[model samples]
Target: QEELAKKQAEALKIQKKNDELRAREEQRHLAKNTRVFELPLSRYKRKDDLKDIAACLGLDLNGKIPELTSRIKAHLDSNSVLQANPRFCGLFG
Candidate 1:
């Protein structure tokens, strides 16, 4: 029915609005709570930066830049160290 369709459309709109608001809040939360260590691996452009991150993550620092990056990524993925926030996980995972 036309009435049912109208109500459904209205409900969908409301749901979408709520989803947007929740996503915005999540971004704010992540911005406030994110730590330096949670930064994406790509952000560490320099080898030294990656080395520092690897050291902090207790990863082996003996490899090349790409190797180190991959190792760190693998460790994070397997351990779920950044599992709390899926948004943060997407940044690096």
Candidate 2:
């Protein structure tokens, strides 16, 4: 009846508020637990930069720009040898 509809609507409103609160709490928790790191790439790089990076990382890119970029990014992500190289290290940091 009308009373039942009113009760259901009130319950739904409460549930919606509870869901919103939970979402906000989860977002706060995630922000608090997150860690961020940043690396700097060279400014004003040209074709020669890619070629040099490929050479230092020993990646063969066959002169393709997309492949060259991805390979360089991957190498910079975790290759200690590339990171340690004074020449390439300057490019990244």
List, residue by residue over 1-93, the lDDT tens digit for candidate 1: 999999999999999999997885555445443335546667777776666666556667688888988897788778776667553464364
Whole-model Cα lDDT per candidate? 0.68, 0.61
Number of the top-ranking candidate, with TM-score as the measure: 1
Q: Please estimate how well model 1 matches the true structure, expressed as its whole-model Cα lDDT.
A: 0.68
Off by over 4 Å in 1: 1-35, 85-93
TM-score per candidate: 0.48, 0.43
Pick out the ten consecutive residues of candidate 2 with the lowest summed lDDT: 31-40
Per-residue lDDT of 52 in model 2: 49
The candidate 1 region of ten consecutive residues with least summed lDDT is 28-37
